[model samples]
Target chain A: MSKFIGLIRNEHMKTFRRLSTWIMFGIAAALLITIAAFTAYYAEDSSGDWRADTEQQMQDLQKQVENGDVEAAAVQQDLTTMQYQLDQDIAPVQSDSLASYMESVMYYCAPFLILFIAIIAGGLVSTEFGTGTIKLLLTKTPSRFSVLTSKYVSMFITTVIFFIFFIGFSFIVGGIFFGFNGFDAKSVIFDNGETVTNNLLASTMRDYGLNFVQTLIYATIAFALSTIFRNTALAIGFSIFISMFFPTISFILSRYDWSKYILFNNVDLTVYNPGNVPAVDGMTLGFSIVVMAIYFVIITVITWFSFMKRDVTA
Target chain B: MQKQPAVEIKQVTKVIRGRKIIDRVNFSIYPGEVFGFLGPNGAGKTTTIRMIVGLMGITDGDILIKGNSIKTSHGAAMKHIGAIVENPEMYKYLSGYLNLVHFARMSDGVDKERINEVIELVGLKNRINDKVKTYSLGMRQRLGIAQALLHRPDVLILDEPTNGLDPAGIREMRHYIRNLAEKEGLAVIVSSHLLSEMELMCDRIGVLQQGKMLGVQQVHEMSSEQTQMVSFQVEPLEQAAIVLRDMGSKKPEIKDKQIIIELTRDEIPAAAAKLAKEAISIYGIQAETKTLEDTFLELTGGKEIV
Candidate 1:
């Protein structure tokens, strides 16, 4: 067991010691700062007249629903949220508030997180082969299974570190742009044809958690590709390609019943949240979890088999 | 009683795509001995080393290190073996100390002091903290050896260890490898195509050719065998050749005004006496010791070592 941890420590040392890994963190931090600055700059100073703005938004959404210019269900949901804000004496979350900025900015930052995690996952195994270090690595006392598992565990630890870094860094940046006074603010969500209120921190954490799951699946795909192809660039490129295009491809294939079985279609577990629609009519959160579990198992098997059974000629 | 062999390769064969790459090669390396694998390129030297190191699978027989089969109990068997398959390819981005620490972590019971000991042993103490990319190839090779020796396995396998090293570095490596075998009682397996290097470095050498083991012989005995080419620089080369033929020298040839005959060291005085009796002036009589290169070429059917 200590040997296993040692292996992981070795992997961590290898990963975190590289300049590219820190550069990834720098880029992520810079991007979040830019996003926070943009949000702060465009935020209108409506602190004293938020009630009137809420009433106007509710009226506009009601008109859009009656005219059939927008989907009635979505517009009605928005209208209900605004009406609840007015009745309950709760102000709508503004772009200048820390809670609202964090909740929204994560949605923008999730893709970059996935991309960075994919880069790390993609290079974890393939770089050893490229650098001819795999020969030295595999000949050690540990079995191939141990070595591969340590690498995967290290990648997972790195993913979690990236997540915490993103969330923490975004919090500081967002707090700097907007005062950190919205900890107890309530977020209005539309769930099951009803306006529901949730603590802003809880709701934002839920979004971040869901995004983390998405990043993990994508990182797994990249890691599997790294093992199979043994090329970092190809693995990372193909992962990004799949992440970018699979949603659109699944959308085009949504007309068919089998489209629901596509990994991309099921990867977005957020669609199974209370109010959002599944890409296919019947994909439950449970069903998506099972599909992802199956994919995770299959990828794990392929990766282990490829790593353990092959010769280390590289 | 003889000591037990540290590593044993018994009838090991490797078939890739229905072609035999290593065929029934058999050998055993004992503790306190430096064994060399001498063969031309494409002769399964690296493949055999890879099998012993558990980097490649054996199709037929098994390799055992310290009585543990590599194919069956890989981790247990690998515990007794430390190796550098080809180049000592360390992570270039890591410092030399971290590279040692990285490999040291993979094995059992290797601690900080052991890491530092290997660093000093390889003489990389001053530059141990420098990143590998800034080091010279010779320094990288030393770092590679440091990593391989970190775990203190009973068997140390180095495939083409002197490759890409300068002459002085090669000599230093040769001396270090020999010292390791002699003082540390480690079984060392070194593979190389350089015949002269093997002659200087190895205690015993196994000649491999086309995936077949020709033979294994002691390094000293290989060159100093019974039969040697004894050349007699005589005043009359033709008369000396005639004398050698009369003396029952098989296939005596005259070249460069000398009569050259394949004779044992015991036959030199008799041949000289016979030449003097035949009134042939023996100006010079030089016995050329057969080099490992000559014997290797003869064993591998004169294939180029490359």
Candidate 2:
């Protein structure tokens, strides 16, 4: 156990000392601060009373649908959504609260989170092979398993800290601009195909948890590729492409039956969360979790086994 | 007068794809000895070193360090060895001190004082805080040596340690390596293609060719005692030739005002004395002793080293 801890400390020191690592954090902070400033500055509260104005707008839309001047299907859908919001006591306004900003990080910035984590994970082991430091590392410990496990454990800790920083930084900057009220406001979600009300904090926390899982899964895939190929470019490039485009592909393939078993179809565990839709029809939260669990085991096993058996020739 | 060997390679063999890369090679390295591994290119020197450090698998035989087999008791055996398999590849983004600190934490019982001691021993105290990427090749090599010594292992194995060193740096390394072997009682194994450097740096030498062990011999036995061409630039060369023939020297050829004969170091003086008694005027007598280079060339049939 002490040896394992030593390995983790060593890995962390090596990782955090790099200038590139600090640059990544800098980019994340800059992007979030800019987003916060833009949203705070451009926010418009022209309605004066949002509930009364939105109710009037909803009546106008309903009148248009009734006159057969617009597509009834689309207008009917919008009316239904607005009615549900009114029922849940949700106002149509630019909410700049701490919880809302945190929610934006969970929703809008998830791709960036996956990108950063994937880059780090892809380069972690491959850089050792590229620079020939694996010789020094492997010689220090007897078991290769310990060396690799320490790296993964360090990555997990780094991911958690990065998540905390993102949320905490967003909260502080957003609160400074928009104040920290309305945290107990009601948010709308779909449960069992029915629109329902939920607390904002509970919904935002749930989304954060789901985003964490998504980031971890992508990072693991990148890590596995690092071991298999020993090239950072290929690993990182392929992971980014998958994270960005696989959902699109899955959407197109959803018409077919086999899309349900594809790995990308099951990665978005947030579909099980209240407000999101699953990639494929009839993909339950339980089914997606089982598929991802199987994939996780297979990826972890292959990575560890290959790393242990292959010679460190480089 | 048998002392226990610090490292023993007993019939170690490595095979890849049913083709032999390292045949059943065997040797032992003892404490207080500087053992040189000499070989031409593609001689499996690096492969053997990798096996010793537990980076590669052994196909047929086993290696034991301090009586612990590397195959069966790897962790215990590795605790007694410190090695740099090829070039000293370190984390370039880290400073030399941080690198050492990180590596020291991997092994058991290496403290800060020990890290400082090694840094001082390798003459890297001045630049220990600089990033490794900023270091010259020689400085990197020195840092590599310092890292290998941090654990105070019983054996130190370096492959081509002097590859990028300048002449002065090589001499400094040679001096430091000899001191470590003598004063600190660490068995040192160094592989290099530089024959003259090996001659000065090593007490005993082992040569490998085509993944096979040619033999291991003492430095003196390999070079100083071997027969060499002794040439005497003398006046009346034909008469001197006759004198050398009368002295029972074989095939003493007189060419270009010189009489040359193959003579061991002990026989050179006698050959000169016989010519003096014959009243042969000898202007200059030059005896050429075999160098490790010449011996290596003769052993491998004139294949290029390195």
- The digit string of per-residue lDDT tens for model 2 on B1-306 reads 178999999999999889899999999999998999989888999899999988889999999999999888877888888888789998998999999998898888999999999998888999999999999999999999888888889999999889888998899989988998999999999999887888888888899999998878687563435677889998788888887885433689887778888777777788889889989888999966555667677787888877
Once superposed on the true structure, which residue ranges of model 1 sit more than 4 Å away at CA? A56-78, B222-225, B231-254, B257-261, B266-287
Local accuracy of candidate 1 as per-residue lDDT tens digits, A202-221: 77788889988999999999
The lDDT per prediction is: 0.87, 0.85
State residue B267's C-alpha deviation in candidate 2, in Å: 3.7
What is the DockQ for all candidates, taken in turn? Answer: 0.80, 0.69
Model 1: per-residue lDDT, tens digit, B63-97? 98999999989999988888888888899999999
lDDT of 2 by residue, A153-218 (tens): 988888887888888887777788778776776666556656777777678777778889889999
Q: In model 2 chain A, which range of ten residues has the least summed lDDT?
A: A91-100
Q: What is the lDDT of residue B133 in candidate 1?
A: 96
